[model samples]
Target: MVLPLSKDVSGKGVNVDQGSLNIKEVIDLLNGDAWVRLVASGAEGTWSLRHLHAVIGSQPPAWPDHDWIYGDIALLRAKLSIDRLKDALVAEDCRRFSVGSIEVEVPEVGPQVGWRRRPSFEQHDRERLQKPTWDLRVSAAQTSQHQLNRSGYLVGRSCPSFPDLQYAFRAFFEGDFSLNGGMSLPSELMVIRVINDEGWIGPIHVTPTHIDVQVDGRDLLGASLELYSTDQRTTTDLNSPNTVTFELPGGLPDTNVWLWLKKDGRWLDYRALYRPWATPDQLEAAGVKIDLPVDPLSTIEALVSGGEGPQVEFKRSLPETKSKDRNPYKTIAAFATMEGGWIVFGVDRDELTVVGLEVDDINGERDRLANLIRARVNPTPPFEATPYVIDGKQIMVLRVDSGVSPPYGIAVDPDAKDRPEYFVRRGASTYPAWPADLREAVMSRQPPAGFPNGMGGLGGAFPG
Candidate 1:
C-alpha cells in the first residue's frame, strides 16, 4: 500500500529531521496491521518499508497471529528488531537501526504477524487499499523484481548523504546511467545575460568552447550584447552569427568549448552550461542578434581586419590552368600548408575581380576539384567544396577546417621526391613554416586520444 507521507502538515511544515509527536502517532497507526507499509522521508526522497513483526516490544496485541509467516526466517528476524524500537527516542532509534550502507528505523510496531518480504508499492495496489496498511501476500504476485533490485541499489548508494541524496537517487531512477560506462562527460545547462548601451538581453549557449557572454534583460529581442572568444580571430557577428551544428566527426572530446555574446562591437564571454559565469545584464546583452549580410568578401574583410571570427588568409590565384596540371593539386597543397583556408577561384588577390577559369563541366569540375584536395594534400585537410553564384558568375568556395597542426606540407608538383615544403598561417597571409614552429605544430597536431590510424591524421573520440 502507498502510504501518504507528510505534506505540509503544520504551519511550519513537517520537519523530517526534527523529532515530533505526530511522527510517533503515525508509527502507532501502523501497529494494528500485518505487514504494514509506511512512507517516510528517506535519504533519497520517500521510501516504502514493510513492517512484518507480530508484536512491538511486548505491546498489547492489536491483530491476530495468522497475519504473518510466508518466507525466510532471516527476513522475519530482521523485522522483529525493527518492531522493538518504534517508541524509542529519535537519537537512540537512529543509532541502533541506521547503519552500514542503508538507513532504516523502527519508529513503532503493530500487532500483525511478520512475513518474509512485502510486495513493492504499485498504482493498482494503491487504489484497492482503504488505508496505508495491506497484506503483503496478496500483492506479491504483481511486484516487479527488477524495479525492486534497482531500488535496493539506490537505497544502498544514498545512505550516507541522508536527505540530500535525492539528486543521485533520482538520476539513477530516471535511467540516466550514461555515467555508468565511465567515459561519458558530465554536463549541465546554463543561461547567459548581456547588457550594453543598446539594452539588456540573454542567449543560451550549449557546451561552448571559448567565449564570454551573458543575458541582457533590457533588450527583449536580444539586440544589445557583447561577445568574444579567447581565440582572438574567433568572433561572432552581432548581426550574423552562424548557427552551426556539426558532429566532431566522432564522439565529443574531453575539452570544453566556450561561446560569448557580442553587442555594439563589445564582447562578453560566458560559460553556457553549469553555473552562470556572467551577470544578468551581461547575459541579456549577449543573446541579441544584429542582422547583417554575410558574403565571402565581408568574411575576408572581417578576418583581415582582426575582428571576431575564424582565422583566415587569402592567397593570389595560381596562373596555371586545371588542364595544364592534370589537377591544380599544387594550389590545393598551398592552402593545406597554412592550417587550411578557403581558395576562392576566379578572384585574384593582387587585383580582386572575377578572372574566370575555363571549365569543361561544372559537375565534373567539382568532382575533380574535390578529388584533388582529398588525394594531393598531405594529411588531407577536412573541407567541403560548393559552388556559389555571385554577380551572375559561379565561384567555388572551399571551406576548410584544419587541424591545430602547423606547417601543412605541400608537394610543389605531384612528382616531387624530397620532403614537401611546409607552410603556416601568419596574419592575413601564408609563409614557409619556421623549423622550430613547424616541429611544435606537428607535435601538437596529435589528438589527445593518439595519432591517426592511417595517413597520420588524428582520430576523434567515440562513445564507448
Candidate 2:
C-alpha cells in the first residue's frame, strides 16, 4: 500500500494518461527487450521521464537506480501490448543518447500560430516597412525526448534545453533515485535519478508558445519564465538569428501579464526588461512628450509643438538653487502622487512660450533642482533631469514617475512659507489635492487623475 502512496493522484501530466501497468507487464518487459524510457541528463540525472514502451524511445539515462512500477490489474485496469512494445522501444531509445549526437533540425511539429506574426501584419511595403518581420525561429523543439518519457510540456514550464545546455544538477542538488518494493536493478536496466521541482517533473522544451530558458548559457537555480501579454505589435529584446525569444504584443492598453513557474512548490521569478516610455507616435497623438529616457535636444524637440495636458505640466523659472520652489517639489509630489508627468523649466507657463533662462552655472542649477526634491518632497518620486539647448534657449526637462508610495507631499517643511504641499495635476495647472482626491489617489493605485477625466475641479483649476 505504501509503494503507491507517494504517487500523487493530483499531479499534472502533459499528454500523459498515467494509465495502469500491471506487475505482469513489468516482468514480461524485463524478460523481453523492454526498458523504461526516462529523460536522461548525464550530469543532472533523470527527471520525471517515465514511459511504458508506448511511444518514442530515449537512452543512456545514466541512472544510479530505477525499479519497475505498475498498477496491479485488480486495482487498476491499465492496458499494455507485449507484441507492439518491442518495436516501439527499438524505435525510441538510442535516438542518439548523447547531446553530441543532436542534429539541428526543426521538429516534425511546426511552431504554433501565436509564435509567428500573422500574414496580415507583414505583407506590405508600408506594413513591412513599419514593422519588421518578428522572427519565430529562436524557439526550438525540445531536443530531449522528455515528452516521449511521458513528462508533459509547458504546464509548469520545465525549462527549454538551450543548444549549449550540457551541465546537470549535481548530487548536491535535491531528491533521490526512485525504487519500488523489493525490486532489484537488472544489469540490463540502467538506473537514473528524477529531476523535478515541487514534485512536478518537467522535461521542458523551448517553443515560441513557451518561455525561453537557459539565458546566455547558464541554469538559474530554479529559474522563472514570465510572459507579458500586450498588443501584438509590442517591442521585444534584440537578438541574433536562432537566439530564442518570446514577444509581448503591442497596441492593446498596457496590462499586467503574468506566466508563473513554480519551483520547489514556491513561486519566485522577477525581472524587468523593458522601459515603459510612450512611443513617439503615442506621445505625438496625445500632444505631450515627456522625455523619460532623458534624451538629447532632438527628442526634447517634440515638446515645443504640443500643448500641456494631464500627463504634461509646465513651470516658470526657479526662485533659487535649493530653494523650495527651485524644483517644484510640491507639484512634483503631486505628479508622483497622481499620474507621473513632466515639468519644463525655461518656458513661461502663463504665456505657454519658450522664454529662455539666464544660466551661469549649469551643474549648480542641476544640483539645486536635485537637492530641493531631496529636502522638500515626502517620499520623492523618481524623475529624470535632461538639459537641452533649444533654438539657443537653455531648457531643463524633468520626467517623473507615478510614485510607488502615494500621498507624497511637503513633509520636509510644514513651516516653509508659500510652499504648496499635497498638490495634483488638474489639466494644465497644479493645485492642492483635496481630501477626496487623496482618498482616490490611494484607492486607484496612484494613476494620474484628469482635471475633468483624471483630476478634479474646473477646467484649469485644482480642487482643494
Candidate 3:
C-alpha cells in the first residue's frame, strides 16, 4: 500500500531510518492519520488509503489465485507498488465505463475447474469504443510489467515521469507505435487520419498495364474527377459514395501529375496525390521494368536505323535552317511541350547520314546552344547538349526529357519580352500546338500541393 506524506504529520511520523517495515505495518501507518509518502512530489496526484489497501489486498472469491498474493505485496518496491496502484485504478475505470462496475460475479467454488484470467473490458463493450480508457489501461499495465522485470534495486525509485506516461497514452490513442519505445500495439487499435482537401487519397499504384488511384469522400459522389498530364486526360464520375476507383489512361508522359475536382462548371485547385509509397520500387515489385536512360550512341544508332519519326529530328547545321518551320529552337520547344524527342545536330535527315560539325571548340558550341535555348525557350526544360564521336565523326546530340512543367514555348522575338509561341511535334515535323493541345500542356503542370490556383483561365496563358 502507498500513501502521500501529509505535511501536517502532527509529530506522528515514523522514523523512515528504521526501514524494512512489513506489509501490516505499512497498511497500519497509511490507514491511520500519519502516512508515508510513496511519491517524492504531490504533483503526481493523491491516492486514498482505502483504494491502495483494496487494490493490494482484495480479490474475488474462487478467483484462481495468481502470483500477486498477499506476501508478494510485502516485497514490492515503492515504484512497483505505485505502478500497480495506478494500473488497478485505470483498469477499474475501464471496467466501470465498459460494464458500469468493476465487480464481476463468478461460479461457486468447485474442483478441477480451469484457471480463468480476468476479462479485459473490451470484451464487455465493443460498440461504444471508449478509446481513452482502453489506451490508459493498456499503457498502465505495460508500464507496471516493464518496471517489474528490471535489472537493479533502483526499481524502488525508478518511475516514468507524468509527461512520459501522457506521451505513451497519446501514442496508443493515435496510430503511432514508434513513440511508445518499442511497444507493439495491435493494428486494429491504430487510429490514423489522412489529411487532404476533398477527401482521403490512397497511394498512387502504378503497374505496367495500369495506374490506379483510390479516392473517397461523401461530397464527391456523382462529381467529376479529372487526372491529366501534358497530352492526356482521364475523367470519371463517382459511382460509389464512399470510395471512387480511378483507372487512369495509359501513355501518360513521365511527369509528376495532379488530380482535379470539377465543381460548378469550374476546375477547383489541383494537388499532387503521390506519396513516398508511389516509387519505382513499387512498380518494379509489380513486374514493371523501369527503363534506364539509353546510351547516346545507342540512341543515335536507333534514330539512324529508324530514320526520322515523331520523337526524332535531324538538323544539318547549328545556326538553324533558313525556313522557320525547320528551326532547331522550334524542335527544342516542340520536344519539351510534347512528349520529348532528340535534336541531332550535324545529321542530314534526307540522306540519313551523320555528316558531323566543323567546330573546333565543342564545349563552346555546347554553351552557345545552351545560351540560345535560355534566350529562346520560356521556362527552360531539362536537356543535355553533348558532343559524341560516332565512327570518328563529331556530332552534337541534344536530348530533352519529357517535361514535368509543360507548355514550353519559343520566343516570338528573342529581342523582345512578349509572350512566346508554343509548338508540338507530329510524325517527323514540328508545328504550332493547337489551342486544345496548349490547354492540356498548361494543365499538365498545376500549382504544387498547397498553393492556390494562380492560373486565372485555361484559354492560352501559362501560370506565372
Candidate 4:
C-alpha cells in the first residue's frame, strides 16, 4: 500500500493523487518491470484509503476469503505493509523484491503452527523456503541493541549517508544466544537497492553464525567466494585464522549475478567496500557502506556478564605455582593453542563478584608476572595482561591470541602426568589438550602460505 516518491520528474511509478485512476497504469508499470519499492513518503498526503482498496478490491475469488482492510491492507504498521503488497502481487504472478522487515501472520493457518515474534523471518517461510531472495543482512547480535552510527568495530568507505545507507540499523536475537554476552554473532548480510533513496536500505549487524546467499529465489550453495580489501584493512576472519583466497569465474565486476559477503572478516578505521549486486541503475556502480560494532566497554560488559564458554573464563586470582591446577597458565596455554580468547581475573568464581584489589605497583606486578611466565612455560604464548579497574574494583583482563608458535607447556618437566600437559578451554573449563588439539596447535605455527619468515625460507636469511 506504500509507494516512495518516484525517481522521475512526473513520479510515474504510482499516481497517488489521482481521484479515479485507471488500473492499466499499475499493470503497465509492472509490465515494464519497475521495482516494487514500497517506502512510505509524502505521497501519503494525497493517498486516502482508496489506494489500498484498489489492491484488495481486485482479490480473486479463489484467494482466501479474508477481508481486504482487515487482512492484507490493514493498518500500515512500519515496514511490514510493503511485504503484504508483495504477497498479494506475488499471488497475481508479479515478481517482487522486498527489504527491511517483513510482515507475517503468526501461527500461520495450517498443519504446522507456531509463533516467532519480531524481526526474525523464519516463521513466515519455513516450508516454502522463499526463493530467489538475496540477503545482505547485518544484525546487532549482542545483549543490548546498538546504533551502528560511528561504531568502533566496523569500517566503511564514505561517511554513511543516513538511516537508509547509514549503519545505525537494529538486529535481533536468533535462538543461538551467547550466555556470557547474550549476543549472537551476526551471520547474514542483506543489501537492498532502493528507489529515490540516497543509499542501500540495510545490511545491519547479525550473529556471526548465519551465513548464506539467496538471490532471485535461489539459494547459493557450495560456491567459491573470496573477500577483497586493501592492505590497510584491519580484517579478522572470525571463522578461521587461515588465509582464504577467493577464485572467481571469468565475469565479475561486470555481471548482474549477486555476490554475498557475510561479516566473516571485520574491518575498521577506513571505508569498507563490497560490490555484490547490480544497482537498480544498472549502468552505474556504487560501493555499499557497512556499519561497525559497538565500543570496547560495551563489548567487555556483555562478555563478562555472559556465561562461560569456549571463549571466556573467570579467575579468582593469578595462577598458583605450587598448586599445578591453581594456575591460569594452563588456560592461557590452551587459548593460545586454539582459538584466541579472553580471561578475566579477580572475580570470585562462586559468586561472579568483582572484588577490588591493590595489585598496585603496576610495574612490579607486571614484571613479576612476565618473569614468572617466562620461567614457567616453554615457547611462551602471545598475550597481553591488562590490569584495570571496572566499577571501582581492580581486575585484570588477559587476552590470548592463537600463538604464532604453540604447543607451549610447563618448562621444567614436560612429561608430568599429575598436572596434565598442554591444556585447552572447552565449554566452560580448561582441560588437558587432546591429541588432536596438540596436532592442530603445531600446524597453527606454520607461516600462512607465502609468508617466509617463519618458514625458514628466504626471508630468514636476510637478517636485520
Candidate 5:
C-alpha cells in the first residue's frame, strides 16, 4: 500500500512552504530556471524553496554548492534579460563576440525550474531552443571591425594595412613594395654643389624624369632653384623639376656657376641645403661671384654718375598768384610752419625743375634774399641762405627752421583782407591746416610751463 505521501512539518505535501526554505536552498533554486521566470514576471513578491539533500547532509550545513551560489542569481538573470532587450532596441548596444555580433540573455523556463537548469536540456527541447538572433545588424555596421587590425587599436599588434592611400601610391611608383613610411613623387630634378659667397656649379644626373631633393625629409613644392650660367640664366620649377632644364650654354667650363634654391618665397643658399662644393675664394678665381654689393652708397654713386638722375630743368616764368609781388613773407611763414626745408630760388614749384638764376652776384643775391625773408616775414624764423652749385649753375637755397611757436600765421595775398590762409605739411605733401590741427600745432610748439602736474590743477580730478 502506498503510504500517505510524507508531509512537511508545515503540513504541506512535501511541496515545502516558501518560508520553510533556507536561504541556501532558496538561492540554489533561484540560480536555476525559476530565477529567469521571476525576473520576466517583474513581480514585487519573493519566493523560496527547500533543499532536502543539503538539510539532511552532515558537516553542519556549510552552505553546500558554494561554487555555484557565489552571486545574486535572480538579480543577475533580471539584469541579463534587461540588457538583452536594450541590445535588441538600441543600435549600438549589441555584443561583439569573436564569431559575430548578436544579442544574448538568460533563458526563460516554467515557474518551478531555475535558469541554471535550462542549458541541460537537448537542442530540440523547447527551453533549450533559446538562441542568439542577428538583431545586431545595425551594431555590426557601426562596429569598426576592419579598424581593429590597425596600429594602436590593439595592444602588442601591428597594422596590416597602411592608413594613407597617397603614401601607398607614391611608394608603388617609386618601386618600393613595402608601404610602411610615407612616400611621394620626386619634385626636384637637379642638385648643385657650391662654396662660400663665390658661386655654385655641378652636373646633376638623374634617371627618372625628376629626382627629389629632400631637406630634413620634407618635399619643397613651387620653389625655384636658380643657377647662373656664364652665358645664360637658368631657373627650374620645384613642382615640375623634370621638365625644366638648366644648361651652362657652352658646356660647363672650368668656371663655377652660382646656384641657390628658393622656397616659400624665400631664397635658401647651399649651406642651408647642406650641399658641399668649393670655397668663396675658389669660386671667385673661377669667375663666379654673388651679385649683391657690399656697399649700397657706392652703387648709388655709380648709378648717379652714370647719368641716371632725373633730367630736370627750371622754367623761366615765375608762379602767377593774385599777389602782385613774390609773397616772400608767406613763403617763409609756410616753410617755418612745417619742418625746416629748402626753398630753391629760380625753381618752378609745380614742375620741380631748376631754372638758372638771373642775378649780378650769386653770393650777394643769396644775401639779399635772406634779408628780404627776415624783414618781410612776421615772427622772424630761424633760417639761413646759401648758394648751392648744381650742374655748374649757382642757385639760392633758403633753409628755414620750423617755427618755435606754430600756427605761424600768413596773410594770404597780404593785400586781400579775408584771404588770410594757413598751411601745414602732413607728410611729404603739404595740406591746408584744419582749425583743430592748427590749434594742436600751436599747443605742441609751446613748452609745458605753468601747467599743473596732475588734474588737480584745473579740470576736476580726471573724469571717472
Candidate 6:
C-alpha cells in the first residue's frame, strides 16, 4: 500500500485520509529535490524512514549483502521502505503517520539538471514494491532468445527447444482511497506474478489464420493459448491433446503476435517475447536496410540508377555458368551467407541499363534457373523466382531469404578433391567468404547462445 506524503515539501503537513489523495500529487512530490521523511506512529513503534543512495551501476556499501545495486536510487529506496510500510499496514499496526514531511538536512534545492527522475504523470495511487532479485530473472529471460531477421512472412517467435523463459510479473499502483496533506494515506498493494505453468510450449506453428502449439509434455485438458499484441489480448482454450490452436480475429499480418503460451490462467512477459522480434529501428541500428522501396518499378529504377550494392545485383543476361567469372552460383551463395537480397537478370552490369531478356519462354528460364541453383549451390537457401516486365522488358528477380543453414557454398566439382567454395556479398560485389565471415555465418545458424544439445531443436515453424 502506498501512502502519499503531504503536498507541501517543507515537512509541514501529512495526508492520511484514504479518500482524496491523488497519484499526480504523489508523483509531484517525488519529482522534486526535497528530502522527504516518513514519520509514523504505530502500535509497535514510532520512527522515521531513512533513505539510501546508490549509483546507477555500482554496488553501494549500504546494501552489503546485495550482489549489485542499480536502477533509480530514489525509487529503489522508496520501494524498500514501502515494503516495511506495507507490512505494518497489513498487520494493522501502522495507525497514524506523516509520509511526506521534508527533512532539514537537504535544503531548498531545486530539481537537479541532467539527472534521471520519474516524470510526473497520471498513475495509480498504490505502487507495488519489487525486490532487487527481480531484475536478474527478467534480464535473463529477455536475453535468452537468438537474434534473427524480421521476415515479413513470419509473425511469431522462434526459440531454442524448451526455452527457459521464467515466470514473469508486473507491478503497478492502483488508487483505492484518498487522504489530506498531513495525515497517513491508506491503500492496498498488490504484487502480480504470471507463471509459465506448462513450461515448454512449441514446435509452434502460426499461419495467417491460426496458431497451433504443442504443450510441454503436459496434459492440456485445462490449458489455453493466448495471442497478445498491440495492447490487445485474446485467449483460446485447448481443443486437442497436448496442443492448443488459436484463431486470430484480426489475422496475422495485422497483429505481430508476441506470446504463444500454454497456460491455465497465467500471463507472460511481453518484453521478453519482444527481445527476439526485430523492429525497423533495431534493424537499421544493425546496419540492415529496411526502408527499401516496395514498388517493383521504383525499386528497379533505383537499383539500376544507383548501380549495385550488397543486396542488389544486376546481370546483362543469364549467368555465365561455364566460367568462374561473375558466376550466379557465387552470388546466390553470398546472398545466403549474408542478409538475403535480389539478383536481377536482364540488366546491364556496367552500363546500368534494363536490357530485357531475349528468351522465348520466361517460365522455362525460371525453371532452368531454379534447377541451376539446386545443382550448383550446396545446402540451397530459399528463394523466389518471378518474372517482371519493366520498361516493356522481361526481367527476372530472384528474391533470396537469409539462409537458416548458413555459410552456404557452391559445388566446385562432383568428382574432384576441391572444397565447395563459400561466398559472401560486400559493397556491391560477390567476394570469397573470409574466415571470420564463415565463422559468423556458421554461428548464426546454430542455436542461440547457451542452449545445449539436450535442449529441443531451435527451429519453429514460422510463416516464412
Quote each prediction's TM-score: 0.34, 0.36, 0.34, 0.34, 0.26, 0.37
lDDT of 2 by residue, 280-353 (tens): 44423322222232335544455545667776666667547434342466678877887676778888766677
Per-residue alpha-carbon lDDT of model 1 for 1-464, expressed as tens digits? 12222453333433221222243433443432222211123334222232222222222112222211111100112233334344332334342343223344433322222111111111132121111122211111113310122121122321222122233332322222233432111111100000112222234433323223333322224333322223222433344332433222322223333443433332222333222354434433334222222355454433334421223323333323343342334434434443344555655545555555455465666677777665556767666666655565555655565444444565666555256666654554445667875676565543334333211221211110
Question: Which lDDT tens digits does candidate 6 get at residues 1-464?
Answer: 11123343323334211222222232232211211122111122223222112122222223221111111011112222333322322234442223323211111111221111111110111121110101100111112121111111111132111111110000101211222212112111111111122233434455556656544423446556666778467776664456666575655534344544333333211111223466654433322232222457776787688778877788778764455553887889887777667788999988899999998999889998887788778787788788888988999987776677777888667333246888887789888888998887666543334432211121111112
Clashing residue pairs in all predictions, respectively, total: 70, 22, 1, 37, 12, 20
Q: Best by TM-score, which number?
A: 6
Off by over 4 Å in 2: 1-295, 321-327, 350-353, 411-420, 446-464
Estimate the lDDT of model 1: 0.35
**Every candidate's lDDT:** 0.35, 0.39, 0.44, 0.37, 0.34, 0.44
Q: RMSD to native for every prediction?
A: 19.9, 20.1, 24.7, 21.5, 33.5, 17.9
Model 1: CA > 4 A from native:
1-311, 315-340, 344-362, 374-376, 379-381, 389-393, 401-408, 417-419, 446-464
TM-score of 6: 0.37
lDDT string, candidate 3, 1-464, tens digits = 11222322223343211112222223233221111111011112211111111112222111211111121111111212333332323343432111111122111111111111111112232211111110111112222222322121111223222223223222322223254353322222111111112333333454433556555443555566677766557887764433334443554346666666544443322334333455654433322233333356665776787788766788887864233442787888877776566778889999999999888988888898888777778788877788888888888877765566777887776765477888977788888989997887566644334332321121111111
Please report the TM-score between candidate 3 and the true structure: 0.34
lDDT, model 6, position 62: 32
Give the clashing pairs for model 3: 5-37
Please identify model 4 stretches exceeding 4 Å from their true place: 1-296, 320-326, 412-420, 434-437, 440-464
What's the CA error at residue 338 for candidate 1, in Å? 6.3
Query: Cα lDDT for residue 238, model 4?
Result: 26
Clashes of 1: 70
